[model samples]
Target: MEVFEPFLAGIDNPDHRDRVEEIFNWVKTRFPNLMPKIAWNQPMFTDHDTFIIGFSVAKQHMAVAPEEAGIHRFSEEIVQAGYDHTKELMRIRWDRPMDFALLERMIEFNLLDKQDCSTFWRK
Candidate 1:
C-alpha cells in the first residue's frame, strides 16, 4: 500500500526502473494535480477522486490500464504495436518498453475527459 511501492517493487531491471520513473515524471509534469496511489497492489493515478490509470508488472510484461475511453481510443495502435489489450488495459512486454508518445496522449485525454460523478453516487 504505499502509493509508489508497487511500482518500485515491480521493476526488476534498473533500466526499466529508470524508464518508468522518466515516464512517471513526464506524466506528473502534464497532470500536476493528479494523485498517485496504490490500488490492487499496483501503481495508480487519480484525478477528481476518480482513478485515471494504473500499472502493474506481469510475468513477462508491464501492463497499464489507461482507463475508460482511452481503452477504445488506443486499441488499434496497441494491437498494431504488438501489445495485448484487455477491455480497459494494455500489456507491453518487458523487453519492449511502453510507447511514451502514446502513453502521454492517453493520459492527456483521460485528464480532459468529463466524468459522470453522479454515477458513483448512484452505485
Candidate 2:
C-alpha cells in the first residue's frame, strides 16, 4: 500500500490520522494505479497531470472533493440519492468505518468518464 506520507503528516489527531489512512487505503484498493500525493496541503489522487479527486480532514468532518465536472455530472444523482452537494463537492461527515461505497462509485464513474474523454480526443 502506497502511503501519502505528507498527507499523513498533516493530520494532528491520532483518530483523524487513522480515518485518513483508511480512506487512502480504500481508494488505493479500488484504483491501484492511482497516483497519490499531497497537493494544496491535502491528499490528492491523480493520473499524471489530470487531477482525479482529493480528501482532507477538517476540524469536524472529513471532505472529499472530486474534480469539477466529476461533481457536476453526478449532482442530480447525488441529490436524488439524498447526499448533499455543497461547493461542488460531496461532503461525507466523518465517522469511523466511513461509508465509502458511495464515494467509490463516484470515483469509478469519474475515472471512466475521464478515460472516455481521452479516448474521444485520441480518436
Candidate 3:
C-alpha cells in the first residue's frame, strides 16, 4: 500500500481511518494481483490498466465506486446486500458490515465485463 500511504495517512479519524484500511486490506488480500493506486483522491484497484473498483470515506458512510456499469449490473445485488447506491457509486453505511462477497461479485463482473476495454475507465 505504499502507493496509498499519503492518502491513508491523511485520514484523521481513527475509526474512519481503520475502516478504510480494512476495506483496502480486504480487497488487497482477496485479489493480490490487482494493482492498488490512489486516483481521484481515493483508493482504487485496477487490473490490466482498467479500473476494477474504488473506495472513499465520508462522514457517515463509505462509498464504493465500481464505476457506472458495475452499479447498473449489480443494482439488485447491492440492495440485497443491504447497501444503497447511486448510478455511479454504492453507499455502505459506516455502521454496517462490509460485504466482501458482494464486492467480489462486483469486481469479478467488472473484470469479465471490461475484459476488452481499451481504457482505464469506461466510456
Clash count, one per candidate = 0, 0, 0
Q: What is the C-alpha RMSD of each candidate to the true structure, in Å?
A: 3.1, 3.9, 1.1
Model 3, span 23-112: residue lDDT tens: 898889989989998877888999999999998888889999999999999999999989999999999998999888899999999989
Q: Model 2 segments beyond 4 Å from truth?
A: 1-3, 76-83, 116-123
Best by lDDT: 3
- Candidate 1 regions exceeding 4 Å error are 115-123
Q: What clash pairs does model 2 have?
A: none
Query: Which candidate gets the maximum TM-score versus the true structure?
Result: 3
Estimate the lDDT of model 2. 0.70
**For candidate 2, lDDT tens digit of each residue in 17-117?**
88788788888888988888776776788764566788777786777777666678777766665556675576655553355666787778767767645
Instruction: Give me the displacement of residue 100 in model 2, in angstroms.
Output: 1.9
Better of 1 and 3 by TM-score: 3
Q: Itemize residue pairs with steric clashes in candidate 1.
A: none
| Deviation in Å, model 2, residue 84 alpha carbon | 4.0
CA lDDT scores, all candidates in order: 0.73, 0.70, 0.91
- The TM-score between candidate 1 and the true structure equals 0.78
